[model samples]
Target: MGQREQVATSLAAAVGEEIGALLAPVDAELLRHYPGDPATRQPVHTVYVPGDTFTAGTVRSWGDQALAALDEHAPDAASLAAVLGLAGELAEPVYARVRAKLEREPVEDLRVDFEDGYGHRPDAEEDEAAARAARLIAEADRAGTAAPYTGIRMKCLEAPVRDRGIRTLDVFLSGLMEAGGLPGGLVLTLPKVTYAEQVTAMVRLLEAFEAAHGLAPGRLGFEIQIETGQAILAADGTATVARMIRAAGGRATGLHYGTFDYSACLGVSAAYQASDHPAADHAKAIMQVAAAGTGVRVSDGSTNVLPVGPAERVHEAWRLHYGLTRRALARAYYQGWDMHPGHLPTRYAAVFAFYREGYEQAAARLARYADRAGGDVLDEPATARALAGHLLRGLDCGALDPDEVATATEGLTRADLEGFAVPRPGV
Candidate 1:
């Protein structure tokens, strides 16, 4: 295998083994982070809204409430400061955290996943579903208030059979973009994916939409959800996910681990506690493998269980998940979910960890490579090979940054290449 392929294979295998061992005792609740595509330069952040809660009337109500609250309280404020505070308070800590995230970092993209109609048929109650989606698109067009974040979610399909999902995706995304007036950078979130063929079907639909709309052929992008038992059970789950993305017109921009469905696939109970279990690792690893160097971001699933208790328990519980999430983010897994506002700290914590670890490790590894290269003009082939392997692994894991990677890899002679060709121990 080529270096990139080798690294991807090793990563997937290592993660699989690690998770297998970790989840042997528990039933597959171990949440694993998927490093996003190496080509993507932007930070990924997605905030989910319950689909059922954001119908036309409900969304209008939310906007109206903010306007009313501001009018009643601080009409003179440039923005809705008074309403911001009240809404901020009423808004879960998670929402406040999301807003804070906007202030603290450049969240390159945003995805709002409505809880209900996503990946399923629109209920009869959604008489104005198409109209509502069009309105959302138009609102997105205004773009004055909503952060330039991409609005995405699985929309209801009108088709009655198995093809309904993709058909729904086609109908909804077309309407959403045309009526909702999404920006050029919009991506569609495809939910409940079971195989590559399903994604391919959607890709065909997207292509047709693009042609009809006079847009670029690949403008219709996707963020896939790996939530099925068949997906998790595949021995080459990572490879399968990669194939699915490729088959889907190669327009996958992101991958999200579906915690609830994944948990159910593992036959675990439906309690909120199921999200963080080790079983989640398998699905996430598959997504990561698929994303390798493709610029497709991979996201870990959300924590379904909310910490509702004494301040101490909430703090401690959140602290643990925060640490876990930080590890994932630093390794290039940019986004995860926050079911409630309380998990905001974890999100910020992830951003801090990435920069801190990236800079520190880059400095250290570059220094070490410099010392070795400067001191030994006649370094033994075996030693050089081992060092090369070490650098390769380190760079892959974000233990070293771009400059360090360049320095460590510079001036590699043919003899050094000979040695490097020989697989190093534990590589």
Candidate 2:
């Protein structure tokens, strides 16, 4: 070879060696961080009840209440029956399935709130509440009435409430562990988090709790509530959600939006505070961006308008809640908060409708994309992922059965469906 060609060849070989040396270890570590499949138990809604009133039977009671309301004001006999999961000649079966699912699993998640819902209870009452919560948890575990997702929401870590919050957490967790050794799928909610330091402090506190109680090191996970403006935009004008997650040291499982508090912090009028307000939407978007692919779930805030009056008025409330939920779903938020039991029917209905409406088209496209047989329409990787995610979520939520999804996607295997969320590197 000529001298110049020989030199070029040698330089290329050296560069290749250096690149391999630099990236091989990093790539291996990256594999460790690769988020596996999303959690199977993605609850469509979290129902919050005040600590004092929460009981093992609270969830089922709420389901009963929702069913009663549906029986009374679901427009007609067919609609009412549909809500009960019965098949009918109605144009849509989504609401019926949702109603039936709610009746079966009315509260997929329950948050015993010590914050706004519980307010500042006296120390004696707080202790009693904690004890009662433990009893209820134990009873639910024995009876199989416990929700798949269960937790407590402590007051914010702000100066005035920080001590109270920590004390409540200690009392509740201590009682819970003693009674039942920690119920399955437990999570804690920390509200109004405005700083990453708060998340770090909570993580350390959880570690201490685990050590003291002989629990596993990472047995507990908590969610950060993005309520105030500071949470979305730090005092120094930097985005703070990702920082907060990092501060949690991998203990952060979710980021939840708080509607009124978030909007109020932005100086919005109380009359205008809502889950769909522009400010709330912007905060949710930021949360989605920050938590994406981190295995940190994002949940939308609740609508304050509750159905609690005459039949006509209750229908209005249902309509409003359905609209707001649809908006959240369109933005890809699969989970939300439901403050009142009455919100249950609409919550599930909106979610089921969203999935049902898009099922056929999504399944067709996913099948075509999977086989690399795009006859007329080109399918991108993102589109395929979105379709797969939809089917997976539908299956998880009971909106669609495995047989339905499999048939729609032309005999796609379960493994094939799961691969959509976390695709193989080159397929």
Candidate 3:
């Protein structure tokens, strides 16, 4: 070979080796966990009730009660009409639609709380509660009235309550499995998580449970409630949300904000501990940043201001609930808590209105951007993804019909929309 040819060949070989090195298989332990798909069932809100009050039919009953209350309080349907931004003349139709939706599916997620909702009980009473909860779970499963997402919220694992909390969890899981098997979409909510160790310990317990019951590893996932100031920041002054998720050993599915508890931790007065408080906003923003690409869902806290009392007073409650829910939606927190049945109407209304109000403009922008037919505007991949996600979310929550979404997206199929939803490289 000529000298020039030999040098060129050697350089090409060297370049090939460099490229191969770059593409080499990553170390098993070093490879970061990527939460694939990100398209799981996302509930609009979780209805939390005390364990003693929980039953297979609890959520359905709540829906019925909510509908009856709406009819009785707003016989003229003015309250719903106002919340939905409809004219007085259109109130009846809109109220009917919301009423029908609640009747068909009253709750999307249900958390039978053994924490604050259940309060502290005697040991025998706690055991009974766990057993009752398990029977209810079986009943709900048999009756098919269980929400798509259902779980129990254990008492906090803080020093004072750790033993009772774990015992309750054990009893509940044991009774549940013996009755039948784990229910569909079962997730445990570990409330008031204040350290990474608590999460690791919880994961260890769950791992043990799976082994003892002959269940698949990772079958049980849990959500961490960032309810205290310590949960947001570790003792070292570093953000601890991601640490908590990692500690769960890939069993953490979500990080739920707790408005009142967090606010109280921050020394906010009871009256000021609200969904829209600046302190709550700061905490949620921290959670958003921490869980951005981790595949862990983020949920806002609930609005404690429920719609109750006389017909005239109920309107104000509806307004407050709707406003708070809309604020959470605007901040991109899709899931929250609903402590009362009356909050149901505004929950659906807010979600529907959010999507309906932006559908036309979002669709047009997405279409133009996809076709590269920009006019008096610029678009990027992030913008495109956001627009696509908005539509997908609307569809997921029953706010937007599949046919309408397809039409709006210029005939894009659900698969196409899913493809669009795939995060860009390094996102």
- Which one wins on TM-score? 2
Question: Model 2 over residues 210-251: C-alpha lDDT tens digits?
Answer: 999888898899999999898888878889987897688768
For residues 179-248, could you state the per-residue lDDT of candidate 1 as single tens digits? Answer: 6444654656777777777787777777887787787777767777877766544566346676776676
Cα displacement (angstroms), candidate 3, residue 10, comes to 13
**CA lDDT, candidate 2, residue 51:** 93
State the lDDT at 242 in candidate 1: 67
Q: What is the lDDT of residue 381 in candidate 2?
A: 83
TM-score of each: 0.60, 0.90, 0.90
Q: What is the per-residue lDDT of model 3 for residues 1-427, given as tens digits with 9 covering 90 to 100?
A: 6666443333667798887777665423223444433676688898898998887678889899888877776654676675446555445544665777788888888898999999999989999998898888877877887887777999888889999999999999998888889998687999989889999899999999999999999899999999999888888999998788778877888899999889989999998889898999989999988887667889998988778888767778888888888889998999898989998888887777777778767777888887888977687877777787888888777777788877887887777766777674334
Ranking of models by TM-score: 2, 3, 1
Model 2 misplacement above 4 A: 1-13, 23-37, 75-92, 423-427
Between candidates 1 and 2, the lDDT winner:
2
Better of 2 and 3 by TM-score: 2
Q: Distance (Å) between predicted and true CA of 1, model 2?
A: 32
